[model samples]
Target: MTCFSPKFMAFCAALACLSGQAPADTAQGAHVSIELNALEPIEDACRISFLVQNGHDTDIEQAVYEAVLFDTEGRVDRLTLFDFGALPAARPRVRQFLVPGLSCADLGRLLINGVETCTGDGIPADACTDGLELQSRADVEVLG
Candidate 1:
């Protein structure tokens, strides 16, 4: 019982151009990261899940998850959220979906962010705010 949507990617794309003390660039493409999973065929074959961390230490209090589709031409097409049969909390929550032939790279990171939140100390002045993780197989997919 979780909420999902495709509109979240729009938010991530906007965060990409930002440059400040903390950069959301760890995601490799945008300020967000996409995680693809293989699930047992209990229901759908296209098992996809996403985990989004604030690329920066801006203190993201809440946000929603989504699935975004991209073509070979580099166009973005947002897909519909799966019918989990329940609504997710109006905050940062985990969500999963089942899409058809979503390939391996057609998806992007989930977008979870609080609309109105108090900014933190803007990261420590002396501490190196940059952090990163190795890109695993679950991170992305490429559509043919």
Candidate 2:
């Protein structure tokens, strides 16, 4: 027969749980997350807001992405470059763009085509587009 103390059994259980989970840093991975925060109607245009987060340890001097907007009928509405300037490390910032001659209700989807420019002092070349995560809080869908 084998016997184990209560303290030893508890320690073993804790170790097993820890082993099943990934480390905190690696869990988030090395990437940038862009969240479509809101859409507002302004005059005859649509104001699109984005919540940008840099998960890297360094600052990003300039980050621009080629975005494509689709109409409610799933047809391409317009293509433009959104420049989110100077993203700080581990911080979130809101950037808004006004689409002239477009209505907020007509937007159905937003697609992140690719990274137009991602530059920083020590950041990787593909830091902005690599493993990019897209989210949306509005009715429109955001895809990468």
Candidate 3:
């Protein structure tokens, strides 16, 4: 028979317990993280890029979010819908939107107001919105 010390057995038990538990961030539930990846000025318009990641086990056939843009003075600039189509499970995708007549310099913040539509097989209706995490890499702030 193989021999294992008492301390080694205790360590093995701890490791087994940890392997069964999910990460701290995903312990609550699956989440969709949207990160404002970048903003670029292109010919009098701003190209906004978002890095989206689906943490769930099911693929999202369609995902749209109502977004609100704020100016430097914190005044609402505009509202629009961003369509991030076909988010595969546990995969990250970058989606870009070009806003006409808007400059990246004038943008203060972008808020994910709500989920306009989230549809997929065997997925919760609120899977895209619930426990959503918003982050920013550009100068503009992003909120959920």
What would the TM-score be for candidate 2 when compared with the true structure? 0.82
For model 1, how does the per-residue alpha-carbon lDDT over 98-122 read when each residue is reduced to its tens digit? 6665553444543221222222344
Global lDDT of each candidate: 0.35, 0.84, 0.84
lDDT of 3: 0.84
Assess candidate 2 and give its lDDT: 0.84
Clashing pairs in 2: none
Order the numbered candidates by lDDT, best leading. Answer: 2, 3, 1
Q: Which is the better candidate, 1 or 3, if ranked by lDDT? A: 3
TM-score of each: 0.31, 0.82, 0.82
What are the C-alpha RMSDs, in order, of all predicted structures? 14.7, 8.5, 7.3
lDDT value, residue 73 of candidate 2? 100
Q: Clashing pairs in model 1?
A: 63-112, 63-113, 104-141, 104-142, 105-141, 105-142
Model 2 over residues 22-76: C-alpha lDDT tens digits?
1114434657889999999999999999988887778899999999999999999
User: lDDT, candidate 2, residue 88?
Assistant: 86
Clashes in model 3: which pairs?
Answer: none
lDDT of each residue in 1-144, candidate 3, tens digit only: 222786665565345334542122334457788989999999999999998888787899999999999999999999999999999886678999999999899999999999999999999988999899899999898988
Q: Which stretches of candidate 1 lie over 4 Å from their true place?
A: 1-30, 44-46, 65-78, 81-95, 98-144
